[model samples]
Target: MAIIKLSAIERRRLSAFATCLVLSVFAWLFTALSSQQKYKVKLLAVFKNSPQKRAFHSLQPDSIYATVQGTGWKMLFSRMNGDDNKISIDLSALENKNYVVLSTQLKQINAKRDIERQVVSIDPDTLYFDLSNRLIKRVPVRLVTALNYQQQFAQSDAINIKPSYVTISGPADVLAKITYWQTDSLILNNLNESFNARVNLHPPAEGNLTVLPKSVTVKIPVDEFTEKTMQIPVKLIHNRNFYDVKIFPQKVKVTFTTSLKDYPDINEDDFEAVADLDQWLQGYRVLTVRLTHMPSYSKIVKIEPMNVDFIVKK
Candidate 1:
């Protein structure tokens, strides 16, 4: 490529041309923006001063459509400043009434914002609301968690949740069927050490429901694990007192995994297996062996035999 160097006079002339182009663009922008026009905008409207003693209330429409008349610059500036784009309505004076918000109220909202813009029109000139009696009840908070521990690591203590209960207030019909408030599902993966974390509560999917203390703290205690084995006697369950029943190989070896801190405390008594003789009475030759009980902090890993021979003795 060949380079053509410009003389000082030529460079000055080029600079002057670029400056004029910028000035012309600015002049046109100023003229266009100085003109006044009407603009339709959506504004978020918040409810305040809800009716007294009414604990549960819902607004029909939480937003509004208002037309503003102002210079393009003023409108542009106003849109950039979202703080001035909000409207508030007071409902404290409502007396168990369904309200129809009129355009007059919307005009007042525009004036309150003092946006230096004329209120032209408000679409959907009306809004509605339904207010009802409020009822409060205490409900249990259930923890939803998917916890996975690394191999040979286990939870040492019970999963702990602070503030295990939550108070909910809503319409009576909505609260009647709610037995408990459950937290949003939480997941902890590859957890090998004890830790604490905060989780949020689940909001009601619908209706005017309010849940207090929308979060809870979870503390989990994790520790190393060890393998343990025990022999538990199999109990025979039946109503045949007139006949002698026998389940050969009555004792079973139960292998389980438990935290090292808790392994020593576990015993055969902590586990239970049952071979229901009722199955034999029902005309089946064999009986199924099932683990009916086990230590809470332990997990059963293996059973010696899953089935037992059911023989009736004379």
Candidate 2:
């Protein structure tokens, strides 16, 4: 511990280490400076030609802004590489003007160095965004039958659909070709009473038609109908009691058409006829009976002779 001192060679080595450390720091600083630089660029957006009206009137100044971060070299390289960092503004947000300024700011490598001023100019600040609204109609759906379904079963029921209408929006050229929107074919067989289902609306293939509400609901009503043949016994009614009377027709044939739900409750008793023999006997050789009573829900399609003939026996 008495005395320990660095030799000449050790001093030289220590000085060299210090110098290298300083030079490394300087090199790092230069590299950083080269990576960070600020510059201005112009942005443009073009709209397709159309007769439709536009939403935005014009863009204002101070709308253009710069994205700050990289060195001038990197920014220039990015520009040459076709790297676009511009923000797109919606045309519908603008009024009658054609262009508007989006934003403007100084871009820099670091937040501290970002204070450098950069001038940015955007030509045609306002962009014309053409837009239009078109009305699309709904087409009636066709009824189809399943392959396995009984062919004899006819469509004797009514059909109902929910949300009968739908709206569509898109490019004017595309929208104009649309005539109507139709749903897929729906098959109903042996259906009774009420039915609820979901269906999709199909757009025409040729147009640029786009439906606002893509889907819709469909409803159909099913009912039962029946045809019944009934035999109504014929009876002769005479005005004078105990007068000898005779009926040529022993029974009357009656056919009724009604709903299946109520057909079972219907019978021949539902119909009747009264004959006035006194008035009919004077000039007529036979008196016929006409229908006087029938079920409200039932319809009489035909009756044999349309009446019952009766003769007076003296």
Candidate 3:
């Protein structure tokens, strides 16, 4: 290949020409973008002001198109940035009419946007709905939680939710199928103290259903646990034949953990330890001690004598 080297003066002239060419292109672009232009943009449709007598479901997509007039720069950036401007549609008309003209709402929709970019027209001009009989019902709210407690710590009482029920309004067929609404998961880990906060409910999965008061207050009681030991008398069962049975150990030490607040309330009377005499018929020499009843909140630590030798005389 042949190389043609330019002199320093020639190189300087070429650099100046390149700079001017770049500046001209930028100036032209600025002029073009400053002029007013019209373009299309996607606006999300938000339905509100639903009629009391009717429940309706939209048959069209949740988004609609708008022809907007604005400066070229705004139009270009609006498309590039994918702005999510929303237009709220009133549903009161559904009480007497089945269709809504979007053009009739152009003034309100434009009011939500910048004055420089006004909506000129709406595509498809009208919206239609599937009508149904509306029903309103009050339903219980179910709390959902995923909680992990620190060692020696546990929930001390029943969880409480303010406003245990919520009112739901929707199509009669839909509301008839819903007995209870569930809150979003309340997740906590390594919890050592009581919890109190407001949590959101799961949104209605169906577009036509609506839940009032989207959130609720939740309170959970927690406390540190301590071990308690008691001497529980063992009772024999299945001795219907009136046979006399004597076990070597008449009592067993029951150790369990209960919340500090509940420790004083729990007693040996709340627990029952039993040995089934029927086991002897199966040729077992020792009777296994089993706890037939215990407090629901207590966690058993150990039973000192899990088995005892017994003598059965008919």
Candidate 4:
């Protein structure tokens, strides 16, 4: 390949032409972007200033909408860049004024200095709130959780919720009516062991109330289970004068369900069967034997010979 070098005069002319092109582009851009245009942007509203003697029980229209106008470039950049384009407007100027912030009152907002755009209008044209005295009260906390255990397993104890009682603070009318606080619902499946976890408290349905200790601890005790059988001695009640009361098969077979963790601590002594001697003395030789006592967390499944035969001596 062959190459040729330009003369010094030609090079200077080419450089001058390049400079002119760059200058022309800048001039065109400045004129195009400087032209008057309209654009919209949102401004945040924070209303903390209220009359010294008044309090708020509720606030309506929690957000403020601002329709603004500005240059094309400014609007494009602001709307595209700050995804959170939020400009807070001071609203303390509106206190104890019949619970409202009118569209014309929007002028009291401090956004004029921050938002370079001119606000053309405000959405809703008005804000609303409920005013009343604040209050505090104590309420009980309730646990909300669903659990499923693996085969041959079950709960070893009752579900335990810490800080059973919580103190709630809010509007007097609201707190006075709330007697209990509920926890957020949770699900634990295929549980084969004890577990401890913290859960959030469910928020009140009304927007005017506040709850203390937003979360709570939950203790779920789980363990494997086993089936067991035992012979429970039956006793005859009433008819003190009569003695030597004979009940066929003096013991009743009691089958029960219990967790393996408490299996070792259980025995036949923990159960009992009883019959009414008065029934026998009343010309009823045959009577039904009842299983009256059982250990904690133990469920009776089947009792052999629900009815028993008996003979008595007067």
Candidate 5:
């Protein structure tokens, strides 16, 4: 086959024609998109200024379609920005009525928006609410945490949260089912010192729930732990025949770790070790030594002799 090549003059003429055609297409598109027109966009419905005397729950979802009159450029820019666009609806009319007409508030809502984004109409023009008895209650706040401690460090005392409870107001049925509110996760790593911070409570995602003082102060005590050894006397119990039992190595070394602050206060009396005579009845020669009592904050490392030999004097 023979290749047909165009001369330089022919190539220049073709390039000029192609450039003109492209420019013409762009000009037409620019004119069309610049014209103002009505378009539908999905907007989130945000309720505001709720009735003070009445509690209400919306009958429809928070999403609604809004017919807005604006240029294609403006609409395109709005979409590129984000989808968080929302329309605020005034609910003060619910004090006397159970429904609100979206058209009635269109003027007020549009007052805060730009001239190009005049909302012409809204689908589901009417909004209805279910009214209920208003209830106010105080509930406890629970702190959620994911914490990691350094070696030889631990929580020393009970966690303290200021204003441990928060007041909540909502429909009676909704509030009745809620017993406690939770804070956002208090996550940390390699925590060696006490933690004191203001944690925010998770906001209610649905219904007309309201939480007062949305944040609280949390304080957690931390300290360095050191090992301590104590000799605790063992006592025998559960002899059905009331036989006098003697246990060898009457005292066992109890190894545990406690905070430095409480090390001086902790004594052998704070711990109780006992051996069960029932072990002999169960055909076991050695009785298991168990620590039945110890401080709540102390960590038991180990017992010197887990089992002890016991003799029964019949």
Candidate 6:
């Protein structure tokens, strides 16, 4: 090999190439450093397959902690393959404890090989929770009505519901305060026949209790209905010498029906039978009696012998 001498210009070119190579390496290092960052994510520790015997009233934080780690473009993308960022805690370890805390290991990191060795301290080493024992209870339902059909139609009858009780189940503390439950209002307006409905029960406002059976079946009996018309004995307000006028239908007919339970208490007086003959002349004959006024519980199915014949005398 012959010794070769390089010119100043050639030497300068060699130096420039070396400097470019060094800068390229530094640029790559700077880019990677900027792209990487330490992120803290909350890890939820859950006890799987925990025994039912464990109550909800007991729980602690020290039993769980989050894993600390560094995330970047490369690792984050690789995470989808098989790298799990989360870990599950053993619930059996929390038995009989109201609270617990746990310390987690610092996960993977990417940095200057030296910087990567730095360990990060997690803010919290443990988590807290409440354990409750599941429970079930039975509650009775009460039905209330604002309208009184019994008094309106002079019918002594009552509406009733079936399966007046239901079962409710939830957390023990939540079920303890619950008392009697109620269903939505059952409307009886214009109800000519019996009806049945499935209603839901609402739990008391302030409690953790949950109703197991949310809904109930109700059978409402409207009771048999009946009506009657009775002739009213009308006495003229004026003396006998008053203008000649006649009241027809000296007797009025009455009709009605009711539930067997109330049939005995029902009578002609329960209905008002009246005939209007004030406009009739002394010789006027043939009057009609009308029935009005009925108890709420009682429905006027129909006025038996709807028409009655009477003579009006003036």
Model 6 collision count:
56
Q: What is the lDDT of residue 205 in candidate 2?
A: 45
Candidate 3, residues 240-293, lDDT tens digits: the string is: 898988997999999998898888888888999999988999899899999999
lDDT (Cα) of model 3? 0.89
TM-score of each: 0.70, 0.31, 0.87, 0.63, 0.91, 0.33
Q: Which stretches of candidate 5 lie over 4 Å from their true place?
A: 1-4
Candidate 3: 10-residue stretch with minimal lDDT: 82-91
List candidate 2 segments past 4 Å from native. Answer: 1-156, 169-180, 188-194, 223-225, 229-257, 262-314
lDDT of 4: 0.72
In angstroms, how far off is 245's CA in candidate 5?
1.0
Which regions of candidate 4 fall more than 4 Å away from where they truly are? 1-55, 59-122, 237-245, 276-285, 312-314
Model 4: pairs clashing at backbone N, Cα or C within 3 Å = none
Cα RMSD, model 6: 16.8
Task: Give the TM-score (vs. native) of candidate 1.
Answer: 0.70
- What is the model-wide C-alpha lDDT for candidate 2? 0.54
Candidate 4 similarity to native, TM-score: 0.63
Q: How far off is residue 193 in model 4, in Å?
A: 1.1
| Per-residue lDDT of 141 in model 2 | 44
User: How far out, in Å, is residue 6 in model 5?
Assistant: 2.8
**Candidate 3 local lDDT, residue 35:** 90
Best by lDDT: 5
lDDT of 1 at 314: 64
Worst 10 residues of 2 by lDDT: 105-114
Per-structure clash totals for the candidates: 0, 34, 0, 0, 0, 56
User: Which is the leading candidate under TM-score?
Assistant: 5
**Candidate 1: pairs in clash:** none
